[model samples]
Target: MTDWDQTDDVGLMLKKVRGIASDRQLMFFACGCCRLVESKLPAVRYLADRFEKDAERPMSRDEKWSILSAIGSALLGDIHPILRQFLMGQDNDSWTMAAQVASIGRMFEFNGAPESLEAAGPSIPRNSASQAQVLREVVRNPDRNIEFDPRWRTDAVRGIAAAIVESRAWDRLPILADALQDAGCEDDELLQHCRLADHLHRPGCWALEYVRETPERSSPNPGDPV
Candidate 1:
């Protein structure tokens, strides 16, 4: 259903994004996805402006490229720009998926980059506080397995994405893979989304040589300007 319903959610919104044929509609749905996931991180400000402009007009090839680049960069906490090499190998579907996952990851990092936890290693650092936050967002008499806030799901998803990229060295993509293999995950699309996150997180090993290790700035605290 269209976002006009207000009942439209992240899953519904993403599917709508993939099917949209008009540039205006695509921009609208894409921005709606970002809004739904709370992608208010400062890194996406340029992007928010870009889409805001597009919401009123059509995008040029360069503008679309900039949008995708921003999404990829934001996923890495605005650290790494999207390298030409990564985009060179992708088709439309592949890159679109990358953009969507990056959007979610950005929201997850809204509080900050979680730099200390990342430095500890490839774990998600999803503390009890994160889980508790999800529980609180839950509604009464919900379906058997209702989704938590999209922002809340990011803890595990972000770690899984990082692990997917880190796992390339071992000739395996565990975390999400093992979950899917053991029938622990119900959504087939989630694995691919995490893989896209992994790709955006690091792109390739050569990226490690450069691309500043930490984001230039942490997310703004409450009351700080966007």
Candidate 2:
């Protein structure tokens, strides 16, 4: 029932995948949503940093609670009200909290004005669409399993994937694709995703997940510099 392309509600899309996506994956989605507004809100950049790090090395529930509480105290006063609402509702289900973060992206754009949503109307839909794209690229599909050859994770593939994950250097994705090819990877979808120019590949990317051999529920460090 949820149209991935047309719907402007990123949260709805995330909701559809709540049962399927891992917590780290949801955090990655939240970080992607936060990055959409990070330039306008520097405080949000810190939030995104923490989320990305958490996505790679997921905290225990108590650790996440403590860290989010600290982050909330430090950031709640500085962000837009919508973002503040999201931070306040961290106890909600992962999809709900992540959807709240996406809502912040949909509603605000900093332009040295208090009430800028009206002026930011055009980008509201654009941000929502972009957030939806992030969700799609990260989750891919609910039932489809990407079969990657274990042999494809040669040293070169591991090195490239590690570097990209550490630096957030997505521009090197194509190079990673080349490494996979050299290692005899035949999965077109997996290889092409690394080569795709327009996609916003992030920390929990399925291709990188494959390289790290992370199960849907496992939270591995993946060499992310926290």
Candidate 3:
């Protein structure tokens, strides 16, 4: 981190971040680098522009969410417009974009996004239950060195739970919830367990109605309309 902070320019920073041994670590540090280099207003905009202008840019699922997750905490005012542009494409992957929006929407504490998976459906259909099981394994242990130590795995559930939630597959959430319960996740963590109906401002979500609404103590950060 100290080394990254001292080094200058996006080019140098990208080289450094891309060189990180772990993809997850690369994502974590890349986001941090963006923020440290002046809160990523330009960087995020650049990414959005590239994503918009270049229709053929081949980005992996991991790369897409890494960008989203890294910027999850960013103020919506700074990124919403470009985000809107990205998510608005009819030919684009709604599932991926929906998951990205869900990540930020949850962190920002709202769901006034421009679109919903319930309306447009998923770009890719997946087995939510099995995916949830895969996620549970990873959350228990994210290490690669433990072959017999019970943490041995080659995949990252990454944020597939968030994607499933954003997809609004209401019926499939219980499968994830069951997995979460089996994995011993409880309380707030459990609340965030792919059941974003509670967090979403969008209606037609069971999670929203299932959990009782309470009085508001404060508003989220301004400039975050989404």
Candidate 4:
């Protein structure tokens, strides 16, 4: 009974989605959260891209751990405590980690102050609002099966989706939607999601995943392509 469209509290959304969302969904959400401050911290885009690529390629547990460890190490020194908490608190579930990253982005968005969580309390609502929208885009209607016609995955559709995913050029989503239409796609939900100018479309985006034929797995493996 969560009012997804109305609720802007990402913490609430994360609680609802924790057990149900796949690793791919959570990773996508995490990247989307980090993307909130990519302009201010250009390194965020690089990290997000690295994460997305790592998620898609198949890897052993050790490999996955190593990659995350390297990333965590790279983030050390002169970083915000929230981000430090995110990387060091490995025991946290993906939902909590993503929320922490969002908090870091909120900090960068304002003053890049290394404010403690308690000190950053005043902006929690605004931070949640931004992240909740990302969670919505990645998890839109878990109960509803948005059927996509396999025939719609034509060369143009796949190419557009791949380019969008690789470049993070979400502005081209409408053009992809147009290509889908040319391929006779009539799914309103899918079409509208593509054409949503205000929506943040990251790699592993639900619509792009559909077009790229990388559906969310019940038990996703990092070695498995996203």
Q: 1-226, model 2: which lDDT tens digit per residue?
A: 3365456566567656766676566667767766766666677678767766766664675565454444443334464564455467546545455555565555544233234434434544433567777787777655456776789999999999999988888889999999999999988778878887734687778778778776565242333222
lDDT of 3: 0.33
Q: What TM-score does candidate 2 get on C-alpha atoms?
A: 0.72
RMSD per model, one decimal = 20.4, 6.7, 18.6, 5.0
Cα lDDT of all candidates, in order?
0.36, 0.65, 0.33, 0.68
Consecutive 10-residue window with the lowest summed lDDT within model 1: 206-215
The prediction achieving the highest lDDT against the true structure is 4
For each candidate in turn, the TM-score is 0.34, 0.72, 0.22, 0.71
Q: Which runs in model 4 stand beyond 4 Å of their true positions?
A: 38-45, 53-56, 59-77, 80-90, 107-127, 167-169, 218-226
* Local accuracy of candidate 4 as per-residue lDDT tens digits, 1-226: 4476678766767666666676567667767766776766666677777877877776554554444443333333245656566567676444445556565555666656556756666754453577777887888666566777889999999999888877779999999999999999998888988988734666667888778876465454333334
Candidate 2 residues lying further than 4 Å off, grouped into runs, are 1-9, 54-58, 65-76, 79-90, 109-127, 218-226
CA lDDT, candidate 1, residue 163: 55
lDDT of 3 by residue, 6-119 (tens): 332323333332222222222322232232223324545454333322222445545655454434334244546555444544232322333343333332222233343443
- Clashing residue pairs in all predictions, respectively, total 0, 0, 2, 2
Model 3 alpha-carbon miss at residue 208, Å: 22
What candidate 3 gets wrong by more than 4 Å, as runs, is 1-21, 36-41, 48-178, 183-226
